[model samples]
Target: MFQDPGVGVFQAWDYVVFAALFVISSGIGVFFAIKERTKNTSKEFLVGGKQMTCVPVALSLTASFMSAVTVLGTPSDVYRFGGSFIIFSIAYTMMVTLTAELFLPIFYRSGITSTYEYLELRFSKAVRMAATLIYIVQTILYTGVVVYAPALALNQVTGFNLWGSIFATGIVCTFYCTLGGLKAVVWSDVFQMVVMLMGFFTVLIQGTIKNGGPVAVWKAAQEGSRLNVFDFDPDPLRRHTFWTISIGGTFTWLGIYGVNQSTIQRCISCKSEKQAKLALYLNLLGLLVILVCAVFSGLVMYTFYAKCDPWTAGFVSAPDQIMAYFVMDILGHMPGLPGLFVACAFSGTLSTVAASINALATVTYEDFIKYWFKNLSERAGTWISKGLCIVFGVACTTMAVAASYMGGIVQAALSIHGMCGGPMLGLFSLGILFPWTNWKGAAGGLLAGITLSFWAGIGGFVYPAPASKMMPLHLNTSGCELRNSSDILTTLAPTMAPERPALADSWYSMSYLYYSAVGWLATVIAGLVITFLTGPTRGGDIKPVLIRPVCNLLCFWSEEYRKACWCGVEHDAADMDLSGDYISTDILAMRREEPTEISKKDGKDSGDDLPGHIAEDRSYTNAGFTKDTDL
Candidate 1:
């Protein structure tokens, strides 16, 4: 049996405030959906009719990035590992700039609703299917964990049953997502982002004030060595070092910014390429603010409980429960603060789940169902999209329940996503960078990448060091100590043990930064080597024209090598057919060879391209084309 932390009993005002907040926030979603029902074109539903501005995109991007993991897990990370995790913000900053300078131009110019559509254009149908499937699986699992973490936290804090919380949250999110589509999700995310930041900063400031001041907090952190940031020892087995955090962290960040649908979908929906880039930059600013607040809150927690150590005092067992413990007990006496914090924490979970459900629905409707049905009616498609939201929502809710047994939602989610994401990123990279990679190479590389990552993850768990003396340099750190000890104790302690070894869990507990490198290397090496051995693919099968210049920059091939390999037929710089607007080869040839620059004076290309009519008719009759197969 569970007991409600008596905070619920004394704080009727807080509960009332929270309930009102929930009603208002959720009511906004329902209202938006009801009002926007008539505006349910596929484009509008999936990508906001590609007219979303920078501010909303920036806000929604922040909300999506800081999920339940950041709300609950970042504090836990700080509590367990200290401020070393802050290095991740540096990686995130680099990723934002990289995305803006590299990937955004290609995706925006392509003008596809789904970013994965670019995979098909550059690579083969098989590669696109594989990459999209990986994303779908990874996101469902990721959403399941996100939905689960907060419900569990809220269950601990508010005494609601875990299943009940999961069901309630999932149902509400699914409802709005199914009905309102991307617009509702994005706008609601803007609201949720504000609440989340307010909640975190409120607790942070109040916690710091109660702990005497920033001086006291810093002194407490320094006493506990919580402020130490740089750990530069070169050990692969260690967790939270500069090397692991930077290199591994960069790839992990790249996976989210570069490959994930939930984030990139926002970028693709911008009103212009410039707006998309601006949103990316603004997201970086928001991330920096949130990271400071979250890290500072953790330091404040150290100050508040430095002497008492409430965790050891039997107040809470798990690190994740630290924030709740602070809110309910430390800040319990304050009025309205507790409710606001709870709302803020819950906002992270809700916004992420809602965004994910929307992305999942779009992928299902566009990629899977449409592929089979060929031409489903708009009404039927809408129903199917709604139905998928319900089905996946329930499935994710169940998985969230299962996540409880996994231990540490943040680490679990990151590890699982890393395993799958590496290959997906690799596939996209190969498609964009290497035009010669055939379906066989791409598919083979994907399989190999996943296999190697799984093997490495398992090996890190089972075998920390080699049996023979000639093994590679085994520089173990405190993070890998547990796993190393566990393996040695299990083997030697049973037969001729003199004393028990102090063991950490398997290196499987290694910080998640390593997973991306392991996956990326495995895929790229296998894919490139196998493809090279197989020789260049057929020219018809290779879409060299679709490979972006930015991708080529990442490739090792020199500029001269690229030019020599292209065999003299230059890919037309101005040829873009992604809008399903095809120009015949004859027409293209007949057009002036020299570039005709369009003047900005007329405001022609600068304005939004969305049609004005509510029900605009699209004809498939340019040059006798019968079916809309371009998509």
Candidate 2:
């Protein structure tokens, strides 16, 4: 309902600031490309030669997924619902801790290039292919939504051509990611992160000042009932309750940080396992900072528009545009400030899209191309990886145009993750935590999860909840200048509750937040059932390094029992034969051999066919419990 204010709002200085973002981003790519010119191997391009620092990787891990979805969506959510969404910080903490303690140790120790590579080692090649396909689809759709966010912002504030902006953003991101690979992506993320923070602070400080100070902002939020923090309701259908946010949100984040290729690629790039752990741990702080700023921005938006009610008064087309509307209404006169915020939105897009395409390229090269061309050269591999980045980049750009028709960028992004990420996470969790889960179980679980999640997700969109179910807080439009009482009454009409939908539509009306948990639960449940019905994998058949030390660390089993639980055998026999049909011959030989023996023999052993990282250390000790080398 809001009118486009047009490109007139961005002054010359504003244009300069916006242009600088792309220039600097491209410059970083060129810098890294030149630095790593001689080392043009797939390993270097894909994971920075496994020599990245903690801070940049930490920032990259945070910035990769914290796109405009969080920047624009969180504030909109707070304004429409309440500030109780901040409780997701709890979920984030749990997600990070689990990732650091359980997931990272295995992936880093195994020296895996693709996150899905472990699926083949633990389950089967079929499982690996399935997981990789899921990841490619999930990241592409999510990147499209992320890229669309900034274009929407640019169109709202500057009346920029939407398709042109999407293409420009996507091409710039593809150029950098393709030119410099992961190094460029991570370093640019560091630069973009600063711009994003500054942009958020600008809105916060200026909006607070315009609405009188922090005290006045707080008063306005309190009057509008926008200060909600805790909700203890037990209803599963009620969105944003403490349970759904903390429990369901924990699963959502775990699906992203735990097994997603974008985050795992950055984590494994650290110079050492310790550095990787530290990077993941430090990312929690970065996530909380971005989250707090975005949440407060919502409070600030409510402070100024508390009386005007921009969406209800038909001054903004959607709730997500409220931030842009607020900026122009109050800060348009301050040249370069509005452009800074738009740049901030694009920064979010660049970091996320670059990360997505890089990860997509990695998985594509490792899972698909390597199999088709078994003897591909390292140099050719690197170039092909770069080409794949370009391909995915264009695909993401095209999808961004399609995403314009998708409602509410935030929900669409999260829903895609729930439908795809949840099943992937479940598959990985079964492989690591439940030793008895077999390849058949993993495949069945993933299929079941995806089917159920898609059914619920599509059904929800088809039969959206009634107005009564939204549970939005009170909003006022009585203070609008020159608006009569009838206009005010009409503006407030949406507040009137309607009858609840039929019970048959209950599943369709379930909270969007619960989709991830539902899919995860479905996968786990179905995986366990299928494993039991077929044949559960024995611990002796699985390599001990593949399993987390859950029984040893968390359970109170006696030493003897724990040893039996270690690899489904007693401590002395923990290195039981790994000559299973599922495992490759080199892997079986490596498991049978000792790392010290290989070291004494100058790395000449049965693992000669294995990759360098795995063959050098045989990955684990004779005990099969301790890693013999660091990644």
Please report the candidate that would top lDDT against the real structure.
Answer: 2
C-alpha-based local distance difference test score of model 1: 0.68
- lDDT for residue 129 in candidate 2, whole number 0-100: 94
**Tens digit of lDDT per residue, candidate 1, span 208-271?**
7889989998997887787787888667666678887777877777877876788878887776
TM-score of each: 0.82, 0.90
Error of 2 at 497 (Å): 14
Worst 10 residues of 1 by lDDT: 611-620
Q: How badly does each model clash, as a count of residue pairs? A: 4, 0
Index of the highest-TM-score prediction: 2
The alpha-carbon lDDT assigned to residue 352 of candidate 1 equals 86
lDDT of all predictions, in order shown? 0.68, 0.81
Which residue pairs collide in model 2, if any?
Answer: none
